[model samples]
Target chain A: MTTVLHSRLLNDVLRDILSPYDLPPVEDVTTRRQLARTLLSGQDNGSFNGLALAYAVVAFCTSTEDGATEVLAAVGDNADVLVLDGVRGGYLLLPCAQDQHVGLARALHDRLGSDVWMAVAWASRRDLASARATAEDVLRIASCRAPGVYELRNVLADFAVLRQPHVAERLARMIEPVVAQQPLLDSLRAFISEDGNRAAAARRLDIHRSTLDHRLRLVERLTGCRPTSPRALLTLSVALTAHSTPQVPLPRAY
Target chain B: MGRGQPVLFDVGRLLHEEFLAVYRAAAADADGWEDAAVSVARRVGSRLISAKVPVAQVVVALRSTDRLLTEAMLDDGGDARALAAAGTALAAELMSAFCAGDDDGLADALLAGSAPDGAAAVYTVALVRGALADRVVNAFRRHGPVLLATSGHLLLPVPEAAALPLCRDVCAELGGEVWFSVAERPAARVALARKEVDEIDALVTSLGRPPGVYRIDDMLFESAVLDTPEVRDELDKVVAPLLANPVLVQTVLALLEADGNRAVAVRKLFIHRSTIDYRLWQIEQLTGLSPVNPRDLALLGTAIGLSRTNALG
Candidate 1:
């Protein structure tokens, strides 16, 4: 009887340890504030090597009022992840090493389903605030990607262009005239997507080869960027990307 | 005070006449009088702001001044550049005073320029449009002043904590069709916040998201993928052939809209199950993408969204 009771107690403890939802949420405002302060101040907290921050936005088919709750529950107790209230969703902080960041993000994505866009960043406790900002930037640059886990490294080039919004705006304007010409825009998009295989592009558009050539020439004439040249193609491609990217205009002082 | 009124009126008249005179002089001489014209315009701007005149009225007055100056300069065959320069100087000084001299405190300061004093507080900037914008403006006025931006958009600034609930309540009260684009920023960056919210609205609208509240954070994926011309191009290509056959296109859209449930799509399309099956197969054959597959369905959904936006244009 004694041996059986001990065995049963051991099983119960193991169950608590293995369960992802074992850790109750940090519900007290004061406790959460203290935790945030401690993590942000870079004090040596024995539980974590670094903080992995994942900022996400979830669009629900229904009302989004409970989005934060859903996101928090989805994050669960995995690696002592803490969910803080944010704009549309929540900020999830995982106390883990660098190598586990991607896996943690993936797990969150799986739990949250397809409607969530998340960007993850790993930083030392000292850089926690900056990491959060970086996560936001990652979200912006990777906004075009399918809903999943994204990192700054994956979107560095796009982020670089977006950082200098004026340059990006100018690049976008370079293709403004082309945007109005649907046929030309379509041709350019097709040609680029087809890797400059004119014949393949023509087939994709279901247009004659000569007609495709005419459209390409019109694109070049209007945009001053030759489609057939490799260097100009790179410019055109970046311009197209910039044209679609949202820009934050500089503030004006009266 | 009564005697001062006519004196002010005479000063205004004298200033107007002097502006015309200087414009005429500069048109011919192209020197010396330009500075005088600028100085006179600056004084006029200061006087207008001091009188607490509305910016719109000031703009109208300036337009009339510009027309008169232009006519006078034209009659004298004056250099058009000189008249333009003077007009710009007048406009600049008026705008500067209108922004800087406003006594309405934080709202006015943020609208005119950044405010370091308000930097400690985070503001949620809301941009609303459509017929509902008026109602929203009326509702938002209880919290703070609402700025009327161009194109009938209303800009409302509220505290960060109160923003979400307030916007949600407003949206609910007005119904789900009402949409608001909101951005949270520090007081010093409210100007950029306006643009940020506007961009969010534009992006989400283009993606065919239902009318509701949207923020930059909520629109990351849609802005990243649906707005990217390259991705749209690729997706458009996938559906281009299907577009030639409206029946097939409709069938595919129905399937996507139904979330790939064949029975639901069949009911929605008012077609038999076999018909939807055949169309799905046809779509797959034409686009080399299967609608039954989850991954392929997402791509097709985005492709159709792009197609619809393009068609609307």
Candidate 2:
């Protein structure tokens, strides 16, 4: 039942994604449209990368052995991942981008059933989070829909953690202060985006550090929270993440 | 023939398409997308599996719809004007899912147990993914223990033949008796969810012994030495002296492995041939068996193999 809950949730997202036009988007039609576009772009790139990551992906054809002439190359060294089916059931080398490579793992799993052993390498910090999120998302959502599809037994986590709505609701509260104080909010956003360097923040805003400080103080006063406080910092961080995250078009759950 | 099962063992398409399809179906609901997807997936999967269609065919169908739905989900990210541009984000999700071996596309539904004959089993459901033969054979082989990855489980379309041999070999090596059956993909799955539906399990149990449909076998090594207690004791007595002296035992075993060839034995033990000779001579003195003798060499080799196997295990 709980598994089905995850399936249902995924269905809602799929429906909205498939039928983006169904949701009325008066406030941010452009925003909604961009959201839909990114998902498509991501899908295209994902398939290529997904193929690369699969425990059972297509091996390259031989166009190798000669450097200057060949339509295709079957060089093992250039391949993204190496899958080994030896030490009993199976094993796989997951070619993952440190920061840039995204969504390859989950796609591979969904494409294959659950009997996969993967060794993933994240190329960057950004990818680390996405990879981890993707792994989590698979566990949470895979079986929720297809009970016997693949063999991912009972390792699903809370999908709300990755769901934008839950993040939006929580973040909405956090962003209220920014909404309450527009100028200071914009300045702070830039400052944080620029990585908390007061000089950079001020330079971006064409203001003195003292002025930036004073504005930040105004923000603290308005929201009863200081930028330095852990809670405030967390809220700000989450807000930035939420802001940056693509709005996935999800249908209104009936 | 001993190796590949393409459609059934695809770990990727199984999750992606299924998850995506469910997501699409449930996305329209007010409940969380998580809830909606899970609900839809389970509902559809349950119906499809229970509908009596061959499990493999059903899997293949799920893969296509899953991919289509997921493409739609990722499509959400394409709208740059939306609250947040999600193309990159959704793309990232899709990619990561693939890497995670959750690519449950349309092909998987048609893997195991031939397509069942009936309209109910052939509900024109959304398609997901279909894996190639070679790829799946390798996937199952590489993923060692399904239990190691608690996050997910595995569904393999093992030929009643190959799997049985493997199970027998493993049981023999593992020093235990193990029994398994085809698990009636559709029934075992549903039954596993219930308190293990007895009738299905019973049917499986009965079928398990039938030499074909669902099968179970064992590999038991009968010991000639253990046929009689005196012979067993004699064998044990000889092993005890060697066990008490690991150095002499190892030296003797190494020498025997080399077939009494001192140079080979020395190389294997990574020791001087003179040291090996000395140990060999000491073993002879203690065991009262000449290292050069054929009877002693055979006995030493067998004993060493048994000892090493037991110790390692």
Candidate 3:
């Protein structure tokens, strides 16, 4: 507790930094704060302390309109960690152990019947400045994970743990590729689905498999390839999970 | 005015817009007392919109009450009759809303109607009283929607309909602007206004409420093949008229039921030959229908059955 970044300080700093993005007025922030406080205050009731770990904070919710209203409905039950990541066209807040974010992502996908991204805290450094340095390291592993899925999570978390400027620059880079590649990847995914198999992918594409293969080869073949070795499948999986756009997998035979 | 689309309202936006709306409505009023009312309306409207229910129709209901107040304040002749007329109109609107569906609009309506200065408030009283009396009441039966906008009330439409002129008329008197929002929504009828009631100094103004309220059972029975547009149009032309001469229509129906046998249906209807024949002629002229075609005969039978059935009952 002594070595770790202080909660009050971190809360103050993050609240200040994110102040500009708060468009619904300070009232919304106030309401959220009050709600968090109320939830935290009922520690004796066990509902509040039941959800959080000793040094961790967690808040999560599900938009019940997705035809799966029952998932995570019980107020008392909660996962060890909580974070938000993009899913389908919107976003979802996920909860589980940092280790279980992967499983929770899978469960969320199952419940909502959609792919979703997960951003877990790999580490929480003392200062925002130092946290940003740590984020740069994790984000470099960005190629192995879905692009913006964890970067924003990492930046937000790191900024939560440490008040460094690095979170912003790194987050800016993280969101740029996601926003850019979204449409291209979206089109490519549709083409793959409609094409059925990769062989069919070529015939309908009016191109040889070699051309299509060359494109896929590039996803793993690039020089700064975080997803290059043993990580190619992992990277593609994260990308697909972050968004429901299924990758044109190497089609297996019957 | 731009297009027939409802102003999108979530809880946050609804509250914001409602407050803004109240601010504007209060500002629009040359008189300042209505600001308090506008404030309440703003709050309630915000909550309803956040719940994401279609309550645009509610605006009009409140405005109707406001218009009545304005008209009364004009100190015009028959002011009592005008206010009474407004009350009936508001009542009728609330009744229509309740009868049409399970009321998700009640909270906003109750809050708005709680005020007592104007027509909207009075209508709310009428509406609450009416809803309490008959659970399965008609549309616009309850009165709260009108009271919310009793002060400087403008005839603002909710669903895709033209607002009542009374709202604009009263608004004019109060030096307020009547901003009518006509949303081009698909579910409701277009440009449809509330029922008209001729004033009789509060002595039971018969609100010519919408005539098409069909209960579930009524709809189910009307689901017969004759309800098809082709058959329905024919009946609307033919059957709507014969509701007058029950004996004549019945005799004609009996004759048709008996396959146009003058002898057998005469016994069926206990009518004279010439009487049946005369009614048959009227039926032919009105329906443009001959008893000869099988389709026309089936249509007649079905229409007669449906028309004779008490829809409200």
Docking class of 1: incorrect
Q: Give Cα distance to truth, residue B158, candidate 2, Å.
A: 4.5
Winner of 1 and 3 under DockQ: 1
DockQ of each: 0.02, 0.00, 0.00
Docking class of 2: incorrect
lDDT of 1: 0.58
Ranking by TM-score: 1, 2, 3
lDDT for B199 (candidate 2):
24
TM-score of each: 0.36, 0.27, 0.19
Q: What C-alpha lDDT, on a 0 to 100 scale, does residue A136 get in candidate 1?
A: 61
DockQ of 1: 0.02
In candidate 2, what are the lDDT values of residues A1-254, reduced to their tens digit? 01111222344335334543433242453443333233322322342211222121111111122310121111122222332222222122333322222244344434443233222223221233233333323333432233222221111111221344444455556557676667887777766555455688888988888999898788776544456432243345444444344322122111
Can you write out model 3's per-residue Cα lDDT over B1-313, one digit (the tens) per residue? 1223343444334333333333333333334424344344434543333232444455553555455444544443434443444334433443343233223333233334222121121121111111222321212223212212222111222321222233333233333221221112111211111111101101111111112211111112123222233334435556676666677556655655565456888888777878767777777676655443323433455456555442522
Comparing 1 and 3 on TM-score, the stronger one: 1
Tens-place lDDT per residue, model 3, A1-254, is: 01112333454334334442432232344443342333333222433322222222221222233322332232113322222111212122222223443343434434443222323232222122222232333333332334233432322211221222232233333323433554334333433344224565566667776665655454433322222121222223223323331222111111
- Candidate 2 lDDT over B1-313, as tens digits, reads 2133233334335545446534543434324544444344444443332232243454355456445654575566422222122222333343332222223322222332233221122211110012332333234333221100111222332323443355344334333222333322331232231212222223333222212222110100012221223333334546566667888776766655554567977898889867877887877766555555433544554444444444544
Query: What 10-residue stretch in candidate 1 chain B is worst by lDDT?
Result: B1-10
